[model samples]
Target: MAALSIGIAGAGLLGRLLAWRLAREGHRISVFDPALGSEPTFDGQQAAGYTAAGMLSPLAERDNSSAEVAALGWRSIALWRDVVAALQARPHFAAIGSLLLAHRGDASAAQRVLARLAAEASGTPRAQALSAAQLGALEPALQGAAHAWLLPGEGQIDCVATMQALHDEARGVRWHWQRTVAQVRPGELVFDGAPSQRFDLVFDVRGAGGRPALPVRGVRGELVWLQAPGHGLTRPVRLLHPRHRVYLVPRPGDVLLLGASEIESEDRSPVSLKSAVELMSAAHSVLPALAEARILRLDVNLRPALPDNEPRTEVAPGLVRINGLFRHGWLLAPALLEDALQACALTQPAEPLVAA
Candidate 1:
């Protein structure tokens, strides 16, 4: 196949991943985003990928999402291994599995989740009902919790590190930072007060940024990072409640990512006080030691969702629009990448433009 000039809108997870993949296939890639940094930094938190906990739980997600999404997640897990190995970056990729815990009051809700997973023949590992002793042995930090289910093969990734490594390693790709794309047509990209640019193919993956042009709605999600001194959770843990479901993902250096608030608005404001209190309180219920943890950061971002909440791909002669990942951006990214590549008819394996 001949190399083609590919124009990608949005430098978020999907955009960066596509650039890294297509650039390696020897395509001349140009990525445009409104975010203000050429390189990923501490202050660079504009994309929704930065605010995510990056949990890759396919079985757990079956409770609310379609089986297709879960299947994509399972596939993405294997693809992530390849991506991390190729990048050689420490994104803290972990496949030790995740836990689903519920208080006595929410046992019914947790049971429903377990039943749903049990009925599906997804080929992934079946969830195991853990006894208190077993749960304690698996995660000693949650010894106080009585009900727990272990979803094997579920995992997480460090989104910030993944994005940074993608940007750093994708050689021969031009990045347009702090530039907002106005429209993406087949093989062409339009910008405000600028001339239109044409490419052999164009990919729209702006996440929530691809609004109006695409049938995408913004669903708000907020996450909080905590610096806990002695919290020893080796894997992601989901605490089930009637009102909201919160998850605690442990990162390197004793840092914990706690979040679960999903509102139906497109607000990009700072984390609200009500959400902070609810998240902190729910987190404390599961792991009491978190009460002493120091607050590190609060992040609020909008996830692009379609009406159906499942991800969709619209393919044309020289364009592909991929969006509506909802809260499963990291979980479904690699599979979506594969689908997009097929839509572009790039069947050959990608070869690196520059040797690593």
Candidate 2:
């Protein structure tokens, strides 16, 4: 395919990933987003990706999501490895897998998760029931756990680093920062109080910003970061409960990301006191060491979702709208990129331009 002009709205995970990939394919790409550019002080709360803990657990997610999502998540994990390598930057892609824990009281919840996983016939690694000794060997930090399941091959990525690297390494692209797209149509982007811009192809990855144009609603997710020094969690750890599931992801600098609150509201307000207490309390029950951890930050962002909560791609003559990723933005992005490119009748570039 010849080099064509492409305009992408929203510089979130999907937008930036699409922009970076298409630019490498020799396309003249331009990106528009209301958020600031990739600056040293870029706030993570501005986009949903940065606020996410970046867990790529297909089996864990399969308990609540569809089979298609789980399958795509597995594929995206492999694609993410390649994309991270090509970026040549440290995004902290850890394939150490994730651990699922349940207290004696919540044993039924864990059993349901196990039953769901067993019903599905997949090529991915099966979840293994961990013995007391095995759980200790795997994650010694997790205490007071009645039962544990180890889902191998699941992983996580540093969303902040990944987004920054995508912005820094993208070539042959023009960036329009702080530009909110009001309308996205085939081959044209209309900005507020500005003239419409035309392109050979247009991608509306505006997420919740697409609003009424697309049947997308904002699903609020809350996360809390803690500075837990001397903690020894190597990978993501999820604690299953009857009401909600809490996860703790280990990050660099002796920090831990605790999250798992999903609310069906578009409110972009700060994290609620009730949610903070619930998340911290649940996480503390699993990892007693976290009780001494100091609170670092509380992040709240809205994930784009449709009524069905499944991601959909709509294609027109020269337009492609990808949205409704919900909480699976990072998990499903790479696979969805492939689907979108196929929808556009384009193939991946044989030689990508990586940062040196």
Candidate 3:
């Protein structure tokens, strides 16, 4: 492949990951993030600093997603494992699989969902179904949960850590932080204050770009960090319910990240009381012990959702737009990034997976 100069207009997960791959392939890459100003500062932290409930399984997501979801999800799992292996020493990552459970009344529903998941997960070993007894043994803290399903081989990483690693890994790419991108025209990349930078190809990834045709909505998720009393809760737990699903991510020491509630609100304000009440109640229902846990902090962030619940990559004459990852950003990232790179001609084809 000939060395190419690539310009990216967002430093979020998609932007950073694409830039990293392009740079590795000997592409001259210049990146600009509106979140960062002229004098870029490397916080050595992940972009957005938002909390994520990292659950990755197309089969598990079939209950709320389409067949295409699992197919794309399976394609990304191996890539994620490779990335995680390289960043193993980084903080805020746990490979402990995800748990999908249910209350007594909804046990059958959970089973049905699990069966669908298993059927779709034929080649994907990261997903499994666990009986009620097995579920209790895995998560002793989960009190009175009638039935449970386990995605035993699935895993989660600290969203913050993964983002930080990407930023740090962009050693060869030109990373411009605090730089606000205003527009993208033919052959020119526009930014605020600085002169427009020209590139052979430019990418528009401003998550919430002002494009009406792009069908993307914000699914707000909130989480609270709490310090638990015991040390045995080692794995991540997903308490599945009819109205809501909750996850408990155990950080180092006794601190456990408890979350979250998915609401269809795009407002980027502080978490509402209604959301808090709902989240706390769901957490308590999952594990009654959380009733006595001390609250550390509360966080709320919006995930870019799409009609298809999958990330879309579109290439124009000299520009490409990538977004609509929904809550499966991490789960579906590898495939999405690969698609972006290929559409932008950043990576070579491997026996031609599909048309570009």
| Best candidate (score: lDDT) | 2
Weakest 10 consecutive residues of candidate 1 by summed lDDT: 347-356
lDDT of each: 0.87, 0.87, 0.68
Report the C-alpha lDDT of model 2 over 269-292, residue by residue, as the tens digit: 888899999999999998889878
Alpha-carbon shift of residue 231 in model 1 (angstroms): 0.9
Taking all chains together, each candidate's TM-score versus the true structure is: 0.95, 0.96, 0.84
What's the lDDT for candidate 1?
Answer: 0.87
Worst 10 residues of 3 by lDDT: 38-47
Candidate 3 overall lDDT versus native: 0.68
Clashing pairs in 3: 34-180, 36-177, 36-178, 36-179, 37-178
TM-score of 1: 0.95
Off by over 4 Å in 1: 39-45, 349-356
**Total backbone collisions for each predicted model:** 0, 0, 5
Residue-level lDDT tens digits of model 3 in 198-268 = 88888876665424436777777777778768735767777666655577777767877777777787656
Error of 3 at 302 (Å): 1.6
